[model samples]
Target: MRTQVRVVSRWIGDEQGVTSIEYALLAAMFSVAVLGSVVTLKGSLGDAYEAVATAVTLAVTTAMALVS
Candidate 1:
């Protein structure tokens, strides 16, 4: 019974494994947040580019019609 108590106490004091698990969880959460933001920004930039392209095309067409 004494040996069992000593073993349990030693295991409780050991903390290397717990610290590594906590670091891994924090890194995973940070990576997920960064990836989500990149996806949202990419979609917004694509829409803005398309809108600018359409506006330029319309202006060119109108100017050509007036000149002809």
Candidate 2:
């Protein structure tokens, strides 16, 4: 029918929803980037904590040896 054809054409040409769709895509991309950064930093942070812990243990043992 002509009415249905016109409706479909109008829907296809409509720009009202474009901004919303673009924003949704932008948000999705930002979330992915943040998640990736967090995952990468997780490993680095663990390594740093381990290094600090080892340093503290060494310092404590040295102090104890000097005291004794």
Candidate 3:
């Protein structure tokens, strides 16, 4: 019974896995932050890209008109 108690105490006192757990938590938080940012900016990014595409298309059309 004494040996079992000592083993249990030692196991409870072990710190080897603490760092790994902490790193995992940090990684999870970072992932959540990135995901949230992407979600929040999804519409804005789409609008920006669409505006750029429209501008490029208009420039190309104007250039072609000038060339012709």
Candidate 4:
């Protein structure tokens, strides 16, 4: 009976699964951060491109008017 109790106690004290669970949680957090940044940066880059496109169009129209 004592040996059985010791075996059960040892089993309860083992921590092999804890590290794996912690690493999994950390990976999930990193994935979320990376995904969120890519989405936000994509939006910002699109806005910047639109602004540059508008400026270029205006400049070209003005140049054509001056030439005419």
Writing each residue's lDDT as its tens digit, candidate 4 over 1-68 gives 99999999999998888888999999999999999998989989899999999999999999999999
For model 3, give the RMSD to the true fold. Answer: 2.4
Ranking by lDDT: 3, 2, 1, 4
Which residue runs does candidate 2 get wrong by more than 4 Å? Answer: 1-14, 49-68
- Per-residue lDDT tens digits for candidate 2, residues 1-68, read 99999999999999889989999999999999999999989989999999999999999999999999
TM for every model, in the order presented, reads 0.58, 0.50, 0.77, 0.57
The best candidate in terms of TM-score: 3
- Candidate 3's TM-score reads 0.77
For candidate 1, what's the RMSD? 6.1
RMSD of each: 6.1, 4.8, 2.4, 5.3
Segments of candidate 3 deviating more than 4 angstroms: 1-14
Model 1: per-residue lDDT, tens digit, 1-68?
99999999999999999999999999999999999998979989899999999999999999999999
Whole-model lDDT per candidate = 0.97, 0.97, 0.98, 0.96
Task: Report the number of backbone clashes for model 2.
Answer: 0
Q: Deviation in angstroms for 28 in model 2? A: 0.3
Query: Native-vs-model 3 lDDT?
Result: 0.98
